[model samples]
Target chain A: MTTTTKNNEPIITVRGLRNTFGEQVIHENLDLDVRRGEILGVVGGSGTGKSVLMRSIIGLQTPDDGEIEVLGESMIGRSEDEAKNIRRRWGILFQNGALFSTLTVAENVEVPIREYFPYIRPPVIDEIASYKIAMSGLPANAGPKYPSELSGGMRKRAGLARALALDPELLFLDEPTAGLDPIGAAAFDELIASLQKRLDLTVFLITHDLDTLITICDRVAVLADRKVIAVDTIPNLLALDHPWIQEYFNGPRGRTAALSHKEGAAA
Target chain B: MAANGAGKARSSGVLPTEFISRTTSRDMADVNGTSDDHQGESVYRVAGALTITRAATTQREIDALPDPLTIDLSEIDRMDTVGAWLVYRAVRDRGAKVVGASRDEVSLLHQVSEFDVPARVRPEESSSFTRVLTELGEWVADAGSTLLGLLGFFGATLIGFANLIRRPKRFRVNAVVQRFDVVGVRALGIIGLMSFLIGIVIAQQGSVQLEQFGAEVYTINLIGRITVRELGTLMTAIMVAGRSGSAFAAQLGTMKITEEIDAMRTIGVSPIEALVIPRMIAAVIMMPLLAFWAMLMALLGGGIFVWLSLEIPPLTYVQRLQEVTPITDLWIGLIKAPVFGFIIALAGCFQGMLVQGNSEEVGLRTTTAVVQSIFLVIVLDAVFAVFFSSIGWR
Candidate 1:
């Protein structure tokens, strides 16, 4: 496959986005753009609406007020059919491996494929599903295993495979490496980086792993004080003079992650 | 945990479609698209993108041919794994050969062709008589095992009680009281209302049947005998099975799935003692109280009907109830309440502990808990009926 970078345009653009639950305002006057071929990592402290932002973008949650544009089209005021068509172009992997528990890993991947292309033959669907499964770094035998039979890491990969079933141009991943061991987490990060390059995919990743952000994020967005206070490269983000940013980057975990990245670069 | 940084990205977004089309296409004009060999073997042609979007086109071209056929990918523009699979599926079991495939296409076909284990074959339908007989045998086996499981659960509960007797300080009084409130106190209104309406309907129907024989006053005897001897305990058990028993199963099943029970074991706490005992004790304590209240409501309801319809005075109705129905009926009904409570609790706990895997199993076991408990309740009540009759309690 020919791989050419298409990086100028934004696939997702959000502006003046406000969400409120009674008197609590999660976001206000927030503006952000997710460009076409980048892995954009969104990080925030707990209760800062990182997931809410992702939810708002994917149309799972409606903002009280906002102008959301996806794929150069305004999404805020679209009809249901219009919204669904836009949503069909993208795939989302929810936190906690939101797989159908009753279905096997292969069947879970086939759900979206079947939904999108009902007339596709079952054997062809299985082939596509198996390919996606292999692409996600899962073992060949994982296809027939049920979600409950899988470990946490395997479930995450299965979820990723399902998300890729539609050959989506854009992918949204929520906390892809939260509960994994250090080695598993690193392997996951590499898998993501490899896939991002191979597919030339635009990835919206929500994560809390410092190493993940440092190693793979093309650009990082920091949510603070009810909105994104900074968006930049790893070095620029580290140099910022914000208190939470300072504590977060200069923190023990961040220092180690930075050291490890530097050593790897030198090696 | 995102990396926050300054603005410019070297690149972000998808690769252009041009990159995919940039791959060199090998044009071998010597090979023709379709050929039917002399051995009755057919060959089809495949072309176009083999990706998800273009897979259907390639599928249609190959799937229309007969089995034991070959496909020529010589004229194919592109083929991905999805496309490769479509071709493979058509030629899987047949005496078919693939000719003129590209190196990439050939590898992809090989990669997806091998199944470590093929998809489990679909179950075939059996003959009707054999199917019925098999189902009958399975049900009998299920019933046998379920009975044994129930008896084991009862013994385990009794052992837990014996341990409690040795260590009274370990009892969870708060848990027992909480369950009593949920299963007993909360159930009063419904149980009372149901038994009262039952009493009223029975009296009304009995009045109609006995009025022709000039025995309208006998409705008092009918209401007292049935309600005290059967309906009061039976209704209480049925309601408890639906509400408290099902709740017990769901609660334990959730704990089992979440590994809370496992946690308890690792920490040296028995799930039987911590979870099952309190519910069992609450059920035992509450069932009789609820059944007694139900019996009293039924008497009051029958009294209402007798006083209103037959113009029977309250004092006369009371005298008739006292004389016609012996104290033995109330005793028999009360004897059943605690037993039914024990059975319901055991059924719930048994099914709950049997839970494995996921939330679906939790729900399935919960339904089975209620059905099994209610069925056991009915069967035991029947046994009681037979026993009491043989002993001439009436």
Candidate 2:
């Protein structure tokens, strides 16, 4: 559970995070450490509190008891404006790609910037929105189209574009490849890796897709019983003695560990 | 509650007497496991006919003939008011003999029962009388409330519109323009067509009526005055209210239900500014234009009537119209159209904002908004007529 940094301190640290709904306790104690400039993947079964953990980290859902430090600031029971200030440093891509239907794709991308960086010139923001949209592999003309007009892949890309709009240091991706075709999902995974490198961002991604986990993640966190049973590099996670973790990584229909190793080595 | 219990017991032919709490407080009772503690309560028979009891077990059993279908209420343990009411309602209407076996049970049965309850024999008559009185009271209260709301809304709208005119950013231009195009431009074709046909019908009818009297030329004046002053404007407003007003309500209501309004607020955009102001401005601006178009189409249609009925040329009817109807009259009618438009849009928006629950609510609010708008339009028209008459403009 030691999370000491080599030189720079960890930007985000969570310890003994717990959340319960009535009598049914979701998580008893969960711990995580996210360093700067690393993509961390959180993989879990349905109802295993992956999203809840992400939400708690982002200060969207308050845990029953936990210490969450984002950018050296405590986030428990903070006022809305204070939390919003904290949120300005972080970006979240919701599972459903929660884009506002009324706003055009470009406007959607411009929202966080408009909210957080009001001092930034409109033209510069617009320029960045367009660039992010293009970087996500969406057409330039797609900026003027509403969320509803875009394809599923395009919508997710647009959502990612919006998430990256403020140049956030930390990014949370909730099921980023959900409802996407395999080609699009792979492209999105590549985009996530590239973005992480480009922005020097600490990414916390929640996903059920093993391909996504093996593809872009530098480290993986397995959430079970509302706790992080394992948090390590992909190779180390695969070597762990947990039944669910082993079954998850080396389960039926898996292409084999060597294939992932080859891809990681190639990258 | 009783009815449900009896129905459940009678249907399954099982005497079930356990009460259970359900998620939804419905008239649900089960003799089977499906209706177990999950569905709430079941019914038990005292003698023959089934009676509902909230008790876990029966206290006493009585023997009575199946002919009268006697139900004993003595053994009932716990009671909620709804459960008791349900039981009473089930047994009361069936002419079944309900014998109160204990003092508390008799009092409970008497308190809730309507069968052989002499006071309830004229229930229909009493309900109808009560309905009439209730409706009267409700109508009076509603009228008072509506009048107050109308006054408040009218003052607020006038102030808002005035403020908007002074400062355009006070309202959403995109919303207004969108609503205007939707209300006015979209409705133009249908309103024009309907007005034309109405003119034709009025002219034909007037011509037939005047033909015997050799006064067919007078049909020009009749059709002109009616179409210009009342029929054209009224019909067009009613049509638009039914079409566009209801549409506004449904669209806004659906948006409200879907949390788009909340999203707008979260983004620091006012729902009123983003939605209502635009619609109100659009409707007010477009109504007069639609009314003017309607007036022209009606006149043209009447021209056709004049040509067919009296052999009066279209040009002559036009000339006569200039002589008979003052431009002020046309202006007065045109001016009222936008007012009608404002009212319709406001009503629609108000009702739209009031909508809750589901799709049924959207439909209900849409209907209510249209009906209310049309009624207000007619009342306003009457008020306008009276005002005009008092001013010697009539």
lDDT of 2 at A103: 78
DockQ of each model vs. true complex: 0.27, 0.01
Q: What's the CA error at residue B242 for candidate 2, in Å?
A: 1.0
C-alpha lDDT values of all predictions = 0.82, 0.71
Q: What is the TM-score of chain B in candidate 2?
A: 0.65
Error of 2 at A134 (Å): 58
User: What is candidate 2's lDDT per residue for A129-184, written digit by digit as tens?
Assistant: 66657766787678777776778889899898888765566889999998999888
Candidate 2 on B1-394: residue-level lDDT in tens?
1111211111231222222111111222122346444332233443332222211122122211232333444344333222343344445443444433333233334433321212110113346788899999999998788668766766766666676779876667666677778888989899999999999998999989988998888888888888888887888899989998998899889998898888998998767666777888788888888888998999998898778767899889998988887676786788789999989988988788777655567888899889999999999999988887687766
Write candidate 1's Cα lDDT for B1-394 as tens digits. Answer: 1111122122323232211121222322222234334355566755544566666666786656776566666555555445656666665655456655544455455545543234321124689999999999999999899889888888888999999999999899998999999989999999999989988999999999999999998899999999999999999999999999999999999999999999999999989999999999889889999999999999899999999999999899999999998999999999999999998998898899889887899999999999999998999999999999899997
